[model samples]
Target: MRKTHLLGYAGFSGIFIFAISILLLHGRQPEISIRYDAMSYYVYGQLGWLLWAGLLGLGLGSLALAAGLWRIQKGAYARVGILCAGIWGTGLLIAAIFPTDPKGSWDQPPSTRGMIHFSAAIFAFIAITLAALFIAHAFIKDGHWKPVQKWIVPVTALTAISFILIMISIVSIFVSHGAPLYFGLTERLFFFMSLCWIGIASVGLLRSER
Candidate 1:
């Protein structure tokens, strides 16, 4: 199969894995809100294989998408954008390998493994956000994907803003010794926007090749 098709499959499958995973877990975790408790499912769910498999698929699929982008596109923006996606994929892989302590276990003293998971989560968020921003810039400058660029710029901005709100909420929670407001909503917004961007870009590239 052509590389573009391969990447398209990967991109589509990555989204599928994430969607299916959440759907499967929805009934199992009645108390956990997907908006705020997605990481909990990945980190602490009893259905370990399901979560791990989903994350693995996401990691591998992201890496494949990055490779496809790098292979098809030229210029510094494309290079840097794809590099960010690659690193984000690597981070997700590592996070899957090092699952964090269970939900409500944060009060316990941090373990080395837990620290690794936390670091990986942070890295993944930063890298994915950067990837979106860089790709938006690339699309604008390249002009070949102008329609995508038009939509991407707004999506990237919203994702970044949501990410910042999440970070702020995290800090507020720690410093104030209380729950920060809208934590789950902001996190979901960030990931949803970023992932949507990835899906759209992948589809656009696939269509362009046809």
Candidate 2:
């Protein structure tokens, strides 16, 4: 198979593994509320290894997509997009290495490891959002990617909006003093949108001529 095709398959496989891991984790850890608790909290559960695997899948998938796009795209915008995507992948890996504090522990001061994990998560989200924007812009300029631009641009917009909602939910949580504000839901939406964008781009790469 071609290199791009391999990368494309890797991207799909990684996402598939992550999705499966999430489903399994949810089923195994019934105590964890999907709506109120952050996904990172899963790391403290009995099926914590599943969460680690899921994070690794996401991190590897992102890196694979970035590699494939970097090989296809050129110029300043493309370069910047690729860099941001790389950062997103790196941040995910960092987050995986450093697990967040226990659930409800946010009420107290964050631990050093927890702070690192939170920072990595934030950086990953922001980097991926920028990656989608810049990459979509680069797609608009490339004839080979023009067809994908139509699909990716809308997903990118939704990703950005979801990210904003996530920020608001986080702020509400903080201001309300650990009150539940659907932060998990908003965060899931952002992650889902971002992953959708990555899947679309990976499919585009798969269909592109070598």
Candidate 3:
């Protein structure tokens, strides 16, 4: 397969993964002391495979458009989404490498797991917002945002709000000094927000392919 097509295929799968993530997070928060062992395993199940899949898409799309964006051309809008996707993928890899079992002692008070999760979220949010701003810039210049690309704006707005949300989540983590509830909500927010941007990108890419 051609590099673009391979990237697009992977991009398509990555978008699907993001969609699954949304489904994963679309519910009420589980109670405290309820270990996420099952969900954690599921998260690992998808995450372990999908991170690499996402990398292919992010790598190709970002490289293809980064130079153009530097010159203020189109598809610059995608650069941040690509960057955030790459960072989210990397963070998943890292978490998988050194995961904290939900019931583990470290998962309790002074949550090392929460810290790791929160920090990764901050990075991811920053990347998503940057990408969205640029994408919006491109979208505006061309006056070509379709119905699907329409999601990009709200997704970006959420991406920006997540910056604040993640910060509060982190602060709440610190204040509570490792409550599982705070940590859990943080994870849900971060994961779903990521899904939003990833889905937005997937929609754009698939539409482009069609």
Best by TM-score: 2
lDDT string, candidate 3, 22-90, tens digits: 344323323322222223423344334433333334434433333323333335445554555455455
Give the lowest summed-lDDT range of ten residues in model 2.
140-149
Mind giving the per-residue lDDT tens digits that candidate 2 earns over 44-138? 78888888888898899889888998888887877898899889988988998999999888688889999999999999999999988887876
TM-score of model number 1? 0.88
lDDT of 1 by residue, 40-134 (tens): 34446556566677778888888888888887678787789889999988888888888776665545676787789778878988998888888
Off by over 4 Å in 2: 141-149
Better of 1 and 2 by lDDT: 2
- Give me the runs in candidate 3 sitting further than 4 Å from their true place: 18-81, 104-122, 140-145
Clashes of each: 0, 0, 3
Each candidate's lDDT (Cα)? 0.74, 0.84, 0.48
- Superposed by TM-score, candidate 2 places the C-alpha of residue 110 at a distance from the truth, in angstroms, of 0.9
Query: Given candidate 3, what's the lDDT at residue 97?
Result: 44
Residue 12's lDDT in candidate 3: 50
Q: Distance from true position, residue 83, model 1, in Å?
A: 0.5
The deviation in Å at residue 164 for candidate 2 is 0.4
